[model samples]
Target: MAKPPPQPPQEPPQGGFGAPQDPRSGSTDGPSGYGYPPKQPSGQPGYGYPQPQGHAPQTPPPPGAAPGYGYPGPPQPGYGYPGRQPYGQQPYGQQPYGMYPQGTYPGGIPPQGGRSNQRMMIVISAAVAVVLVIAGGVWFANSNDGGKDDVAGTSGGSRGSEDGGGTDPTEGGGERPADADAKAVLQVPYPSSVPVDSMLVPGQWATAKTYAKPSVYSITGYHADTGKKAWKLPLDGQVCASSRHVTADGRTAVVFQERKMSSDSSSEPCNQIAVIDLDAGRKLWQKKLPGDRVYSTGLSLTISGNTVASAWIGGSAGYSITGKELWKSASYRGCRPRGYGGGKALVAVTDCGSGIDNEYKVQKIDPATGRAKWSFAAPKGLKNVNVISTDPVVVAVGAGSVSTTDIMSLDDKGKLRARLSLERPEHGQPKYDPNCRIDTESCVTVAVDKDNLYLPSEEHQGKSQYGDTNEIIAFDLGTGKPKWKSDAGEKRTILPLRMDGDTLIAYRQPTLDSGGQVVGIETGSGKQTVYLRLPNETSESERRLAPGYGTGALYVNGRLFMSRDSIRKNSTYDKELALAFGS
Candidate 1:
């Protein structure tokens, strides 16, 4: 075929796509223009343009576009006629396909140099949606009402009030005002008669005193703030014993001689618990037990609310203070039971035997109804066991080839929630030489205050020899985590632990001396205050001293009770000390 004649180059439409066409041009401006098509350049085709000879075939238009839309021209092809009107304007009343109606594009189509306007619109819509979601979340969080209900459900809820509520002080079911006739009264009773061996003023109570001649024993009493005898309970008979117990409200006094009996094998059997009403000189109540069981002098007598409990041994049958019989297992042969923290609950351990075969059984008892709560068989190799506390939970220490500790947590219904083993250093070579013939297997003393437990350990040589070298370690009762450890030295042994406000007063015995000493220590700060030596001097025939923070006084009945003889020896020479507190 003959080559087509060369044509002149054509100009692109003046207006871009989407722009209005000018009436003066008499035709649409863009690629879709109507009427005569523009001419092509030399070596290119005109109007309905065709490809040059040997040129590659061009791509077709999109499905909806005209046949030549998007088609690439030949290398030397000239610009073609404006294909159609720019996309913006259309025949009047004949809307452009796919274009939004007029006034829809308030700012018109966005600049098209980079991304398509449609893509930019989608991006902006997504960003606005994300911002709205964030704002909604923030508002919901700030307006939360859950915390208010939480506070209202707490113990302190009643103290809260709504705004504008009148200050009648009776809103929200608050307590009513006291009656006109209501009077503030002291629960404790005042002392009356004074004992002959009285030492200090009536405000002080006498814990214990020994007799030198005739019948050998001690007679102690509780005194009142007015220097009067509240109650006088004698620690007499051949098997005399006393325990330092505090009332639920923290009244300090000796719970002595729940029952008394003669040590002589020929004496009549007695089985009564003599509960001394310390503040009133009257007996609270004496509950008869099975036999003449007696408690050691230093054991803790626990009192919670109005119930008092202790571990006693004497009768053929072993029983708790609530009159419940204890299980007679082989594991509880030589061991004596002791109680901790008050409640209707108690923990006790009984010896199994000696050596590898040795074992102990720990029992939980309900004090209120005299019922058995739970029982656990300790490891077979344990040589000794001690019950620490039962309020927060029940914890016991077992000693054997390896010193292992076990803790048990109980719910209010006496159900075991968790059984945990406390961590301790593995048994290794003895810290002290093997030749050091000391009592290593002695029973460990365990005490608990609030949520912390204090365990007994040997004192090191770093501190004074007279101090308790073996020390007390504190552990979190709830989690069994260690809190702190205290080393007073080797000589000091924790006896009766008392608290005056936040101060901890431990009745300790110095190793250098045989008797006990009252050491005042701060609970929170772990600081020591007074270290008053107990009246245990050998040379002094008779002496009496008052210790502790408050009124340091010692009284018997309404009079001061003096110590007439040292606790050690009560030979024939000290006759006057015999009549001190009355045999």
Candidate 2:
């Protein structure tokens, strides 16, 4: 018999005081849930063993044992796990807090229910960066026969064009010199006195000249190659959210509170929106949102061409790049706009109905007219919808059994072309991690090119007795079939960052004795070339700063920038908020 749907956890108290326990720990020794922990002796506790509160401890599966089939439990925190207050209670569609909503946030994990599923999801550490610790590989084992039907188009062209425009650090210039030594070129310290709870600080962008990151109440631009601060733009209150897109000329948007919260008794509404010039480090314009309620929550922002869009639990609106109102959409067809996926195209995810009848619709919106170019209805009984790629129109949906069960690809007509199952009978439970958080369009570990989708296999015990490793696999978007697999050498695991022309630029996690590396994999030939290698001395810091499930990473020119998506007061790793590594 099918199990009943899990109940949502209780709403957490606001003001950061009623933060819930991590709930991810297994044995008392340490956190053994996420990532591939090394195997221990028979009597010792092993990795991947997760025990619910007051329940008997679970053990790892025996080596080479056929894994049992089960569904995914709630999202487990990967790295720098944010507190549970902002991530749970709300689910996806409901308006939990009104306009003055205090702690609701997107980007990582939906709130889990009280009952635990016997099933376990094998996940790597949730860094905005994917890290797999191993020691044996020098290069990806290239296969001559990878994608036989490689698609050709201009969509995945030069990195500069794909990402709006600016300057291409690697345009006329070839790759960075082979011997280029990477060191810490920039580092930002965490703010002091931040309550020991999760706070939104979610923006990171790079241009030819500047690398911009958001702090508590302001955003700062730093010299791309040097660590010097170029300019800082302060706001009246906290930065609640930031658009991942930048205009061709270097402008972007963010949502902030109207007034600063000065005490636990006071609250501010996250209804103020603004556009800023990343290069000049100044606000281009600011405006107030309409119909904000005192207790409403949930907001997501994105940019497509000349449109800057915002969606919440009750309504969604769009504005011109210069801040002129474009259109407003409220509840329609018993559904409201929840979020959007932008860039290359504009798409919206609308939540419809309630309870088991809950359904989601993905609509391709006309950026200027705010009309649906086409709409695709997702399968019923799904809990969340995450837009992975807008240009190709791929979405990740979680149904009754798994957090993310299927990845659906759509054609230009908004018709389903392929559906790739993450939970395969052969693999037992889900084995691939697209690394999507709760926010729409926040899948980080997955990338889509013209014809193929790229994702990392789950980390598992490698050849070395104590090490774990995984690989990047390519699948055809049209047929939903495997195209090729590129192993991440011996010890290290690699993740897709973005496509640079025909090459897929990826980051390789560091090993114990070495620093991390940025490599370019030629999609056609399956060739891998090291682009940048950090010094061995900074390996420790590189591990902590890598972007994966919950953070952000940007590779421009020859420089790579990594920063935390959200900040908490108790971070122990030098309180380093951001880091830039380059020669």
Question: What TM-score, computed on C-alpha atoms, does each candidate reach?
Answer: 0.39, 0.71
lDDT tens per residue, model 2, 502-534? 778788877766777888877764567788887
Against the true structure, candidate 1 reaches a TM-score of 0.39
Give the Å shift of residue 518 in candidate 1. Answer: 6.2
Q: Which 10 consecutive residues of model 2 have the lowest summed lDDT?
A: 51-60
RMSD of 2: 16.7
lDDT digits (tens) for residues 87-133 of candidate 1: 11110111111111211111111111111101111111101100001
Runs of candidate 2 with Cα error greater than 4 angstroms are: 1-180, 264-266, 294-297, 330-333, 424-428
Measured by lDDT, the strongest candidate is: 2
lDDT of 1 at 253: 22
